[model samples]
Target: MPVQRPFNFSAGPATLPEPVLQQVAAEMLDWGGSGMSVMEMSHRGKEFISIYEQAEADLRELLAVPANFRILFMQGGGLGENAIVPLNLSRGGKVDVAVTGSWSRKSAAEARRYADVQVVAEGSGRNIPGSANTWSLRSDAAYVHVCTNETIDGVEFHELPRIDNGVPLVIDCSSHLLSRPIDWSRVGLAFGGAQKNIGPAGLTLVFVRDDLLGHALDICPSAFNYKTVADNQSMFNTPPTFAIYVAGLVFQWVKQFTYAGLQGLAAMEQRNIDKAALLYTTLDASSLYENRVEADCRSRMNVPFYLKDDALNERFLAEAKAAGLLQLKGHKSVGGMRASIYNAMPLEGVQALVNFLKEFEARHG
Candidate 1:
């Protein structure tokens, strides 16, 4: 039997599939007979270009990205995109944001620097505030932004919200990208960092509709300009080659993944649903632990829960670590525990975590 390795539940810079890690290891010194690793290759070299093309193609196919949307492999994480999105799409006009959690709140703050920022909807940081009619959406706004999944707050929008005004809808899906299929009809653009679910930090993915490309503000840098980056096939400046390579492998893995007769994105989404259900079920049953996010909005990717006794937090983390479950500690902003079950984390990993949770509660409850 293959020996078990530790299960990691970090929110970002999270776990990667063992097979993808192995493949990356095997290609460390030489990738497909190329003398240099992906990290060493020139960004403009044919070899790296081939890697870039394949990665982009695989991602487009896997996500079912529409023909009219341009896919960009970018640097800077979700945080940087907070500024980049406003610089490109805001057009120095009104920008409306739905502040559902920490990430979206940050997005609104960053955007205020470039546009007339308005908070259309505000959640309690735990629950999305209200229905669409309650959102004070402005018809003249350049775009409306939402973070479909908030990693820190453990809130998610199971169904993408509708923007009635035909204004573009931008989603910061850094935590849940590729875990499910996207509805292109409603989205004007989508962006995500490749860490939580895709592969690594430094790589960001942007999908922008054809019409949204050329409106970047005057201050937007050439490299950060979506139109410039898209025009150059994401090579306007040197892309994050290594991250893209690993993400490509992840995309391939997701495409071939199978579950309950579903394949690819469908398979991934179903598995994520099962994993989240398992952990949430365990938490709900335990008198010693509880998740605060509402049931309908709970994130399948990141789950933050609290132990009944805060004094036991340290012991819980240490015990979980010793049990081969890692990074169960929640974000510092929220004093509790979190389990980031990304695409790479198998059901077995979550089960191990569930078992550990039960044992810990039994001992300390």
Candidate 2:
């Protein structure tokens, strides 16, 4: 029998597939007969180049990204892209942002440093705009920004808002990048950090439309210039080779993932849907726990809940840790427990968590 690992619920720098971790461990010292660890290889070397190219191609295929979008592997996490985005795409013009939750609020604040940022649509701490038409987008705005999934607030946008104006849409999909299919028709740019669902930290993926490149402001660093990074295929500076390698393994793992007669990304999406539904159903039926986000806006990946009796918070987290469910602590800003069930978190893991939830609630309720 296979050994069971503790289920990690961290929001970022989160869990990866066990197979991917195994492959990384197996190849840590030497990769593919190159006699060199992936970490030791030069970014420009063919060994690493092949890894980079395959990672990009596999991600493109997995996400069904259009040919017009350029996938860039760069340093700095999602927050870096918050500034880098406005520098490249804002052009000092108006940027209309839909501030739905913590992450989008941060995105709006960051963009304000580089452009005239507007809160086009505002959400209560517990809810988000129901549709694209609800936003107050500007006709002349350079781009409209949204964070598809807010890890902190436990909210998500099932469908991206569409802008009939000429302006494009830029999204911070850091938390739920590969959990489901992205409707690319409504997105001009999408960015995410590898740590959440892809790979280790320090690698950020930026998918930008071809037309949006080459428009960086004069002050933008050459390394961060979207056109420059694209021109060099994400090697403007030394790319995160090890993270890319691990992410490529993840992509391969995702491709081979099978579930209920589904395959690849399709299977991953279905599994996620089922996992979220199971978890939410359990929470809904309980009197001891509550998830505050609106049913329609709740994130499938990040589920934040509270104990009816706040005094039980520490006891709950302690018992949860002893039960092998790690990182169940909530963000300090939001004092509650959060479980981030990202792509790599198997259904069995969620089931284990669900089992623990019922047991805990029964003992406490």
* Model 2 stretches with alpha carbons more than 4 Å out: none
Which window of 10 residues has the lowest lDDT sum in candidate 1? 125-134
lDDT of each residue in 223-290, candidate 2, tens digit only: 99999999998887988888999999999999999999999999998999999999999999999999
**Any idea how many clashes model 2 has?**
0
Tell me the deviation in Å of residue 157 in model 2: 0.7
Model 1 Cα lDDT, one tens digit per residue, 253-352:
8989999899999999999999999999999999999999999899999999999899999999999989999998999998799999999999999999
Alpha carbon lDDT of each predicted model = 0.93, 0.92
